[model samples]
Target: MTETKKTTEKTLRRFTLSWQLALGMASGFFVIFIIFAFVLSQILKQYYGRLPETLYQWLGITILLGGLFVFGFAFMLTRYILRPVKSIKTTIEAFEDDPMTNVRADRANVNDEFYDLVNILNRMIDRLQSLIGAQQQFVSDVSHELRTPVTIVKGHMDLLNRWGKDEPEVLEDSIKSSLAEMQRMETLINEMLNLTRAEQIPIENVQEVTEVGGLVHRVFDNFKLIHPDFIFTLDDDLTQDANVKVRQDHMEQILIILADNAVKYSLDRKEIHFALSQTTNRVEIGIQDFGEGLSSEDAARVFDRFYRVDKARSRAKGGNGLGLSIAQRLVKAYGGEITLESALGSGSVFTIRLPLQRENKNDQKLSN
Candidate 1:
């Protein structure tokens, strides 16, 4: 019991980080002051030895002056050293109170490691805000997109309930339309789930270096088979193997999304082009179609979730407008970028750029 009591008292004596720092600095200064006073006392005693009666008085004066100097200097030093820490704490408290506040720590004038910490914290706050915005947008999109099919199903059911069941043709039409709407709702839910997963794919799953040329050609073959009516062609400018760090599924999904979009829009031309190019720093895959192109305003938002440049055309092609969005998400998650270019009368091209690795020594030697 006595040992436990002593341990508890010791723990209670522990100071907060700021207090600990102040106490440590004060203790160090006090130690030095004690040593200096001791040395001065000896010197004073030696010089005033003849006046031995006043020896005690001189020593006391020396100790008092040294104690005063040490205490005052230590107090100011501790406060000055911890000023940045206090500022960071206050900024954090303000941010917690109002997340949208644009409060930042004092980093511009100060040059210290704490500046790095503050910069990181500010970046985290920005990312948090972006995530919250994305989440709200996602919820709004789901609500808006699902409303059409839901309304259609409900209206048809109401019609059937109101004497439409007695008519054979109306009964059959309502049943068929309700079933179709239900299927579309199911697909929408699944695609939304896929979009969410695309945003959160495990990075470890995409750490492997994949040769992109072969993968592109494989997709070309698959598309050729899938859309035999359309001419599928591959144009390559690969002096060497173009490689990117990505998973096979990620590569395939992105290619299929672009190729599918090409096929959908190229109803008149019945041809799709796949262009693959490689450079020292990056690899590019372009999916081009000679179809009715989009205006600049629509092209700018091609990858936006549930955005359709031509709503009727997209619906006819059975596109919920999530395919390109998912593709863009996957590409970005793998440290890559996807872009679209189009003139209103001409065709559109979707290009993907992924960082490339330098040629290895063995590949260089083999080429030589």
Candidate 2:
């Protein structure tokens, strides 16, 4: 009942402005007509002795015509002012019904206030689109990432109960496998939390000059230490002069995530390649590995949080599957992009592109 009342009040308020303007115009015209009628009567009494019988009739006819004209003019003026507002209301209704609907208002030749409103609405729609896409991707990726660990945990428990009783060593191994699966689950949960935290924190405070090549080298060296069996090589294309404006820690984390994933998924003792190059406006970094490459469908979802191509293999290799997602987010935060190219059995490559800074060039020139 309260909601209904509130809605009715709102609708009444919307019409109030037009009605007020009409009433004001009507009052002003009435006052003017009275003054004119009084003046004419006085002039006739003075110059023509007394007013003729048709004088009153002619005066009434004139007033009636004037009132009609004023009414029409006021109505037209009110409608002209309210047209854009009505359009905005219709667009909002459509959006409420289906958010995917694109209802853009024409801004050309429009009043400045209306044009500003249209621009704001367009920006709001763009943000809504991004948010909805992210939400859908999160749901799909989380489902895929959870399934493998649950299956493995169940399988290991079953094995432990069946053969574990007969062989002590088998029981221990089964228990260990279950523990490993749990650990994988824990890691996945941690990665998800980290990703969420990263999304929530504003990046406004994070500004610094970052050396692109040096950051990549540090990440590579760290990965080499962690996965000693994997052969890693860095291309010399990236010079010491390559630098960009970004948060240093965030850039390092992005590189580490990509390089770490490459090392983890690559075949044992296989070579992983890291390459970097600078252009006039941007810098590109690539990480490639000879691993069990993904299918087209997998490639499409690799950057989604918690999505993995090979479920069993991903669990066996202890991947939470959020590395690429985190890496992509970090890259985008720095006004950069991350893309993947992969084929089954051949290999996979991940590339990152970041915008170059003027300060970087100035620094390089000074050093030279």
Candidate 3:
């Protein structure tokens, strides 16, 4: 009750800008009227013994007209100043009442502060609409993707409850199929979580400096060990050790993802290339795979969540199709970029570019 009372008091005490401006103008006019009346009375006393009754009447009439004019002017000026604010308020209220309705604050004819404010508001509304559309689409896609496995599992459970429990073959197959579907769902959920996490990297992680060359070598060696049959080659042209403003673990993860993708898509030729090079201002890591490459259209959307060149093959290979999306998000978070070059039946090369972390000479001198 006390807090509510305090909040109510604060709200009641708050003064609107229009009221403040009106009061200020009215006060200034009142002060000027007092000064003018005093000066006129002094002039009358100096010029004559006493002021005339007619002069007093004329002064009273003039004061009345002046006061009325001052007040009227103040009211109009306040209204003119607050017109834009009222328009913005009405637009926001309408938007709040019907969020789906695309309402925007009207822009002013003059390029002033209010015009800039209107532009910002329109941009914010557009962004909100876009986010709402994307959110709806995302929810729909997730539901569609999960429905298949859920339905399959439920169907198997119903079969087992009816008669499959007694038959050994039916029970075995149903159990395996159900478990597989459950595993796929688990994988899908994890990837979705990873994708979300990739979008919002921690502030501390942004400040982290990672040596790119070592991470590249580590991932290359790991992949070689995992795929002994596949030929792996590393081309390291970086004469000096280069660092980037990215977490070591994130860099390693990106490399592993690209390498894994290369291994997965390699149809006949089991050859993968890991190239590490550096320019003056950036470090580049390229993972080239002689795999069943993608078409131009597929390559364009390969980084989209749940997109796959071959859905059946992707499912068969236990791919949830979120790896590239996560990689792309992580790369972009640190002001890096990931590019894909592929031609059907030729090969694919995934290249990542990261800004090199510059060494602070002052810090180095301080350490010395």
Candidate 4:
């Protein structure tokens, strides 16, 4: 009963501007009628059939007085009705001047609708703040990561040129180091460019119906060719079903990034495992490596841009640290999720979960 009464009160409070204006006009007209009735009746009784002219004067005065009163009352009602709207306008102007300002209305004295709107605006501002913070952090990380590699390449080249002929072996190693650093820098720049392009383009630009198994096999084949020393294996439990709706190129890039990371970080360089599985509603692809796995803290930040658990080793192995970050972004762009599981001294597994297209009921029945 209390809830019902509260709901009815809420309904009554939600009056539109037009409805309020109409009500104010009606109330003003009712007041005019009351004044006219009282004044004309008194004037008619006072004259008592003696003089209609005297009654005419009093009737005119009554009409004039009623008009004045009604106008004044309506003016006051309009001002009262527009007060909250004007306050909201002023608050918005202040927020525009400084987006970080926590400007909020006094909810206890305002309409519930206005109060709710202010709450939603505050929430939106909070989200914008978080996004801006993340962008700033990304810029800082990129600058630091890129600067170090460029500095190393320059230093090593300078040394090789100064004493290259006198110390041939030293000069040769310096050149190799410089070349490796340059390649690392190139990879980092390319990964960052790909991430930027992925964000700039529309989703429809890259959407396609791709064969998941075939794409994985192609990436694996490329990886094997590039890293001839490492043994790469593909387990094809998932590729049998061919109805996964995803961008073919994007999926291949994601797979390559994961496989490359696994191969680079594996301890024994024995084998890297790639497997695909399909469920009723989803498909999951996992890349597992038997490496010196990440600690809990490192695992938590593994996908962060330019973050590496073993920074020295990452530089030595020519990793730019942007591969996982790019892969994560690409997977998320397709309404998919990427997850990592790892433990110290154990292996790491990265999983990508993508939604599977449902087969039409008619087609399924026909096939059955």
Candidate 5:
């Protein structure tokens, strides 16, 4: 019984807007007719005798015609006003049914109000499509990356299961191989988590300030101690230390990623240069390495997640290819940008540009 009641209510509520508007107009006309008849009767009885039957009939016919015209006009006007709304509804429904659909709301001949609404809807569709595409690509890449390590580990286990465990050397080699692959997988998963965190910096920590020069110096010193064979030089052109609105740890991580990349790619000339400078309103830090530089195409896409110029070499060097991507995300989160410059023979220089924090109201010009 409850189901039947719900079905009946749904059927009744399924009336379209046009019909509902027409019914409302008809009801209004009925009220007006009753009021007019009451007034006419009172006036006629007060001043004259009863009217003729033919005259009453003619009056009724005139009112009926007027009501029909008004009802039709109201229905047509309602449809015209709701045209854009219907178009938007239809497009959204289509998109919801099939996310891959490229349909967008039509904006032609719409009023200013609906034009803005349609524009916003179109922009939202574009953003959603972009995010969907990126998500699909990321999933595909992750699956591809995991397949090799997973296969290697599984193959070794199968070997050990098939009587290889009886041989001491074979069992030991298989165990080592499986452990290495598992370690690789663990590293890849951790880097993925770090990339996710980089994309979403906490809003409360956005105002955290760090001294740019001090952090750079610390990174430089640490790397020098770690890689003593390589030549390291620091060119600090900033007369006074500059401050930026970013967490110290985040800034240090960015520096470390770039510095580590510089150290990794150096082949013959094991030299790294750290340069820090400030402009009127900005601070710039650059890491330069005399290394195996990249081609134009490689430099363009070097910061992309899981992108490496030489995939085999990067894997051998224990790089999961998420470092630069994480650095880029962190820099942009704090309203800064990182850029790269390199050629086939010449080495690369990765530079980070950030807005310098103002010390006080009187501070205007920054020392070059």
Candidate 6:
């Protein structure tokens, strides 16, 4: 019974103001006309004796015309009220047939509740379309990336099975090639898992005030030790009061990804620079490298998973092309943005902007 009452209420709620107005107007007119007709007929009979046939005929015609007018007026009002709902239904059906259509709903000034519902549904559709497109592209990129290595390994194994097994030279070359491809595959899979985890990482997981300068210093030291042949510079222009809203570990991981990319692309110039600066609202961290800088076209897609500027060179450098993409997701998960600026042969700069946290005395104490 409770369920039935709730359902009834829901049904009634769908009716717009116009419907209620039309119903009330019709009911009020019906009562008024009934009383007026009875009163007029009695008065006419009492004063003028019997009524004429023409009078009755004219009265019948007037009643018919009034009823028709009322019916037309009520119908027009009801239809106007339902116009938004009809549009919503049509749009939904059209989308069900082909969702590639425009994801927005076209409706006039609908009732308040229904207007809100339409807006929510359109937003949901936008998100759904985005998720679907991303998933499809992700699958395509993964398959393409996996295919090359798998084909290489399989080809080498086939060669070994056919004749390379007995020939020592072919056996040694085939074994090395297969092992290298397998390692590449492993690295790609691991990075893909990292991106997946980054996508689902909760805000609470990274809810900590991390000092930007110290994090960069640590990363600089680590990279300096790891690549002793290359020059690493740190330019810290931020105040000691600079605190960013991010987890320390996530921030470090982001720095590592950017630094690694810089090191990989350092063509002839073996220098990499890390810079930290801040505005009133945001903290900016930059990793600049004098490298085989990418063209605008390449720069645009550099953050896409499995996208590499030079596949052959990337393979040679043991890069699976997922580093930047993973870094982007990780940074964005913490309300940060990662961007790239580069030109052909003019070096590249990767900048990460994190929203600055409100100045906290506790953060300074923690850093100490």
Q: Identify the candidate with maximal lDDT.
A: 5
Residue pairs in collision within model 5: none
lDDT of the structure predicted as candidate 1: 0.82
TM-scores, one per candidate? 0.79, 0.69, 0.78, 0.63, 0.74, 0.70
Candidate 6, residue 13: the lDDT equals: 64
Per-residue alpha-carbon lDDT of model 6 for 1-368, expressed as tens digits? 99699667656665555567777776677667667777888899999999999988887787767766776687677777677776786678667867766846664678886888888878777766666665666677679788988999989989999989689999999999899888888888888778776775667656678888888888899999989999998888987566877778778889999999899888888999999899989999999999889888999999987788888898898888888988999989888898899988879999999888885799779989
Question: Per-residue lDDT of 114-167 in model 4, one digit per residue for the tens?
Answer: 777766765666656555655665577679877987899889878877887799
Candidate 6 lowest-lDDT run of ten: 10-19
Q: All models: lDDT?
A: 0.82, 0.78, 0.85, 0.76, 0.86, 0.82
Tens digit of per-residue lDDT, candidate 3, span 4-117? 996576445433566678778977997799689879888888989798899888888888888778877886787776677766776776777776676777776524868888
How high is the lDDT of residue 7 in model 1? Answer: 58
| lDDT score, candidate 2 | 0.78
lDDT for model 5 comes to 0.86
Cα-based RMSD of candidate 3:
6.7
Model 3 earns a TM-score of 0.78
TM-score of 4: 0.63
Model 5 alpha-carbon drift over 4 Å, by segment = 1-15, 29-62, 105-131, 193-214, 238-252, 278-282, 329-336, 354-368
- Colliding residue pairs in candidate 6: none
